[model samples]
Target chain A: MSQFFTAAVLTSTVAAGIALATPFLLAALGETLGQRSGVINLGVDGIMLLAAFATYYVALRTDDVLLAILAGMGTGLLMGVVTAAVSVTLKAEQGISGIGVYLFGLGFSDLLFQKLVGTPLPITTPPQVGIPLLDQIPVLGGMFFDQSPLVYLAFLLVPVVAFVLNHTTYGLKIRAAGENPAAADSLGVSVARIRWSTVLLGCTFAGLAGASLLLYDGIFQVNLTQSEGFIAVALVYFGAWRPSGVMAGSLLYGLVGAIILTWKSLGIIPLSGSDLAATAPAVITVLALLFVARRFRQPAALGKPYEREA
Target chain B: MQRPVHRRALPALLAVAALVAAACGSSSSPAPVSSAAAPASVAPAASSSVTPAPAATAPASAAAAASGATSATTLKVALVAPSAVNDLAFTQSMVEALNSIKARYNLQVAISDNQFVVSTAANVIRSYASQGYNLVIAHGSQYGSTLQQLAPQFPNVSFAWGTAGSTFNQPNIFAYQANSNEGGYVQGAMAAMLSTSKVLGVIGPIAVGDAKLYVDGFCAGAKSVDPTISCIPVYTGSFSDVSLFATAAKTFVSNKADVLTGTAQAVVGAIGVARADNLPWFGTQWTQVSLAPHNVVSSQIYNWAPILEQIITEIRGGKLGGATYTVTLGNGGETIQFNSGFNLPANVKAKADELIKGITDGLVNVPQ
Candidate 1:
C-alpha cells in the first residue's frame, strides 16, 4: 500500500491528473456561467475544437504561444457570437442549433488541421513557471506549482466566477432572465444582451481551454480532444448548475482519470492485447453521469425558445 | 379531355423507348466493353509500349539485356500511401523506392497519398485504374481489405498492397510487407541488451493483426537474447494520443523497466517521459533518434522503398504475379538503426554492433 503511494509516483500522478483536468475544468466552468443565464450552449465543444485547431495553426506559424492562445480565443469568441446570434437573438431551437455547431466545428476543424499541418511537425511550448515558495513544498510542489500558469488560472477562475454569479448584480439579472425572461425584460433588464454576453464569455473560456490543450501540451493531432466537449456538457449537470459544484465535479473526473493512470502504470489492471486503457476517461465519465442522475435539476427555461410576441 | 388524348401518344413513345433499351441490354452485355475485345484495346497505348516495334525504332538486344527483360518501355505504376509522402521515413522510403524504379525503367508513375483512410483507398485505386495504370500499390495494412475487394473490379490492372500479404491469392492482387516483425524483433533484442534491470517494456497500438505480429516478434526477440528477461507489453488502442502514451511510459518506468519501446505514431510522448526519467527507449517505423536525444537508443526502421522498387520492376517484366511477396533482412528490406545520440554506453553500442552483424550475416535471426 505504501509502495502505491510513494512520494515520487504520487507527485507525478497528481501533476498529470491536473494537466488532464485543465481543459475540462476550463470549459465546464465557462458553460456553467452560460447555463446560469438559461442558455444551454452545446456549442462549447465546437468552439473548443475551432480554438484547438486555430491555436495549432498559429503556434506552428508564429512560434509564439501567447499569439497562438489569442488566436484560439478569437476563434472561440466568433463561435460564441454565432451561437448567440442564432439561439439567443433569433430564438432558434437551442438544442438543434448547438448540434449544428458541433458538427460544423468537428468537420471544419479537421479540414483545417489537414490543410495546415498535413504531417507531424515539431512544436515547443513556453516553459511552465513554478511559483517560488509554493514550488519548493515537497509533494504539493510538483502537483500544483509545477503546472503551467493556465492550470492555476483554471482553478482561480472557479471562485472568481462563483463570486460574480452569487454576489454581483449581473449574476442576479442572469438568474432572473434565465428563470423568467419576461419578468427580467419588463424590469428593463435587456434579456437579449445579458444572454449574448454570457454566451460570448462562456465561449472565451472554452477557447482558452482549447489553447491550454494545444500549446500547454507537447504536440497536436486532428480532432484530438474527441468528445471532451460532451464531457464538459455532462460536467455542468453533474455540478448541479453551480460554479463551486462544477469545480468539485471536474476534480472528481480528474481524480478518476488519475486513478486509471496509476492503475495502468502500476500494472494493477492488466491490458490484454490492445491499448484500451486510453478509453478509461470516457468510461469513468459515463459511470459518474449515471451516479449523479438522481440529483439533476435543470433550469426551468433551459431549452425554451423565447419570443417577444405572443 | 384534351389531356386524355395526349396520354395515349405519351405511352406509345415510352413503349418504343423501353423496347430499344431492352433490345440494347439483351443483344450485348452492356458492360461498356465486351470480353471479346481483350483489355489491350482499352489502353492501346499500354500494349503498344511493350510490343515489338518496327526494326528502325527497335533498340538492340544489348539494351534489352542491360535492363533485364524490359519488354515494356514504360511500366506505369501507381502508388497510394496512407500517410503523407514527405514523412521522411516510412512513406518517404516507399516513394523514394518507386522513384528509383521510375528512373530505371523510365516508368510512367502516379503516386497519391490516401492520408490514412479506407474510403480514400477505393477512390485512389479507381482513379488510377481509370487512367490505365498498369500497377497500383496500396501502401499500408488498412488498405488490405479494400484492395482485395477492389482488385477484381479492374482486371486490366494489377495491385500490390503493403504491410499484409493476406490479400495475396487473387492473381491480380499482390501483398508486400518488408518484414516489419523482423525489425520489431531486432528492437526487442536491443531493448533487452540495453536494459540494466532484467525487465523490459513494449507499448504498441491496438492489436490488429499487424500490431499482434510486432508484439509477438518483439517478445520472441527479447526472450531469445536473455532467458531470464521479463517482457511487459501493453497497448494504448490509439495511434496518436500523448496523454495515454505518457501513462504507458510512466507504467514502464514504475515496473523497473530500464528500457522501453513503443510503436505508437505519437510515441514521442512515451519517449519524452522516458528521456526525462533517464531510461533508454526504442521506437519503430521512423528513425526517431531526434525525438529523445537523451534516451532513444535505437529504432526499427521500415525501409519500404526496396519492396516497392522490386514490385514495380517485376510487374514491368511480366514476372510479378503473386498474391503476396514476403521480404526480410535476407532481402535487405528492413534495417535496425543504432545511434549514440541517446548517449548510450560504450558496451551497449558494441553489443548492438555485434547483433547488427549477426543479423546481417545470418547467424542471428530475429524470430518471424
Candidate 2:
C-alpha cells in the first residue's frame, strides 16, 4: 500500500482518469446539444457501437486513424439521418423513436462484427503527442497536455460546443425550437430544420466518441461501449443540458472509475470486494442526478414531436 | 395526437425496461442455490455403477439404451454459454475444444450462446436434457444451480459443468476444472525473469474462480523470483468492458510496469495497449498471439479435448457423473504455447522449459 502512493502512481492515475473521460465527455457534450434542441437520442450507445466497429475495421485494414475516425463519423451520420427521418419527418415520438434507433444499432453492429471480424485482432492506436510548452508543466502537464491527439480534440470540443450553444444565432434558434417550437415556427426559425441539424450534429459527436474509444486501445469487441452511451445521455440531465455541466459530470464519472481501479491495485480495497468499488461511478452519477433534478428544468418540448399547426 | 402519445409511452417504457434488464443480467454473480433435494425414486448409484438398474423406465431411458447399443453411438452434446460462441475468450475456448472432438467422437453438438440471463439459461438446459442429449455441458459457473436442479430430473442424461470442483455428490454429474495456477505460476516466473523494470501488472476480470487463482499464482511466482519486485493486480469488475481494461493497462504502463498479463475476453484491450507500447504480455484461456505477434510472450492454452474425451468415455462405460476432472500442466489438457514471433532470450526460454518440466515432474507445487 505504501508503494502505491508514490508520485509516479498518482500521476499515472490522474492521466488515466483524463483518458478514460474522453469518450464520455465527447458523447455527453453531444447529448447536451441534442437535448437542448428538444431531441433526445437514447440510441447513443448503439451509435457508439456501430461507430467503434467501423473505426476498428478500418484501422485493422488500413492502419489509418484518420480514415478510421471518418468511417466512424460516417456511420454515425447515417444513423443520425435515420433518426431524423423517424423523429422529424414522420413526427414520431422522439423518446420511442430513439429506442428504435438504439436497438437497430445494437443488433446491426453485433451482426456485422460476427460476419466480418469473427475474432479479436490487434491494431495500432494513435500515437501520443505532447504539446510543447504545456507538457513541461510540473504535474498538470502530463495529466492534460501529454495525451493522445484524440484526447485533446475531445477537450477542445467542450469549449467550442459551449460557445456554439450560448452565443451563436443558430444556438438561439435551437433553444427557441426546444422551448416553444410553435413560437419559433411563427418567428420563421424553421423548427424542423433546426431540430434535424442539432440531432445530426449530436450523433456526429457520438460517432467521434466511438472512434476515440476504439483508438484508445486499438481493439474492438461486441458491447465494447458497455453502456457508456447511456451514461452520456444521463450526463445530459445531470449537467442540466449545459455543455460545461456535461463536462463536469463526465470528468467526475471518469475519475471515479480510475480511482476505483487505483484503490484496488493499492490494496485499499480488497480484491473480493472490488465489485462494490466498481459501482462508485454509477452511484455518484445517481446522487448527482438526484441533487440536480430539483434545480434544473428540461426544455418544454423535449422528447415531444413538434407538429406545425395546419 | 393524444392516442399516438399514449401508444408511444408504452414502447418507451418497454425499451427502458429492456435496457435495465440487460444491465442487471450482464455480469451477475453466479447465484448460490443449494442442490435440489434428492428424489427417493432415483438411486444415487445410478451414476457410479456400470450396470445399474434403470431408475426411469421412460422413453428417455429407452432412447439412451438404444443409442448405447449401437457400436458407433451418436453422442449428442448441448452447451450453454454465457457469451457469444466466438468471443475469443472463455466461450470460444470451449467451442473450439468441442468442435475439435466432435468428428472423432461421433458427436452432434448444439450450442445456446449469449444466455447471460439465468432464467433463460435454465430453460435452455432443461430443453436440451428433455430432448435426450447424451451429455449436457453447462459451460459457465452461473449455471450451477440450474444444472443441479435439472441433472437430477433427467437421471439418464449425463451432466457436466465447471471451473467448479463440486459434483454435488450426484452420480450423473461430472465436474471439470483447470489447474490454471500451474500455468500462471510458470508465466509469472517467466515474466519476472524477463521484466527489466521489476514491476509486473495483472488485469483480471472479476476476482474469482480461475481469474483469482491465476492472479494469486502470478503474484506468488513473481515474489518467489524477487521479493522486491512489484506485482500489482487490478480487477476491472467486468468481463466485457474493453475500455476499462484498456484504461487499466495504460495506467499500469504509466506506472512503469514492463510486463503485463490479464485474463478474459476484455483482455484484448489490455493486449492492444501492451502491443502499442511494446510491453511483454502473458495470456491465459486461449492463444492471443494473433492479437500481438511481437509483444505476446506465451499463452497458457486450455486444451479441453482430453477432458472432453474422458467424460464421454465415462458416460459410455456406465459412469454418469459422481466424478470430478481437472486439466493441468502435468496433463496435455493445459499446455504453454510460446509466441514464435516474439524473440525471447535463450536463457529465458530454457528457464521456462525447465519450470514446465519441474512442475510436470512433481518437483514444484503451485499454490492455489
Q: lDDT values of the candidates?
A: 0.68, 0.80
Cα lDDT tens digits, model 2, A223-277, are 7888899999998899898888888888899888887887776668787688888
Once fitted onto the true fold, the runs of candidate 2 whose alpha carbons sit more than 4 angstroms away are A1-6, B1-71, B117-119, B130-132, B153-156
Q: Tens digits of per-residue lDDT for model 1 on A1-310?
A: 4556787777877777777788889999889878888898776777787898888788888898889889988999998887787777666667767776775665567556656676555456667789999999998997789878788899999889999988999998888777887778778898889899989999999999888877644555545565677788889888888887778777777766666656654556676723466577677767877787677767766776455444
Number of the top-ranking candidate, with DockQ as the measure: 2
- For residues B1-368, could you state the per-residue lDDT of candidate 2 as single tens digits? 12254544565555555543443432222221111222223221112112211232223353345434542656778888777777767888888888876765667788877666689888888888888888988987778888888888999999998877888878888887888888899899889999989989898988777888888888878877888888979999888888888888887887778999998778988988888888999999888888889989999998877777667666766667777777788877788999999998988788789889999999988888
Interface-residue RMSD per candidate?
16.3, 6.0
The sequence of per-residue lDDT tens digits that candidate 1 reaches over residues B97-173 is 66644554556666665245568567767777778878877777777777767777877688887677565467677
Identify the CAPRI category of the predicted complex in candidate 1.
incorrect
Candidate 2 colliding pairs: B171-B321, B171-B322, B172-B321, B173-B321
Quality of model 2 by C-alpha lDDT = 0.80
**DockQ value for model 1:** 0.11
Every prediction's TM-score for the first chain? Answer: 0.94, 0.97
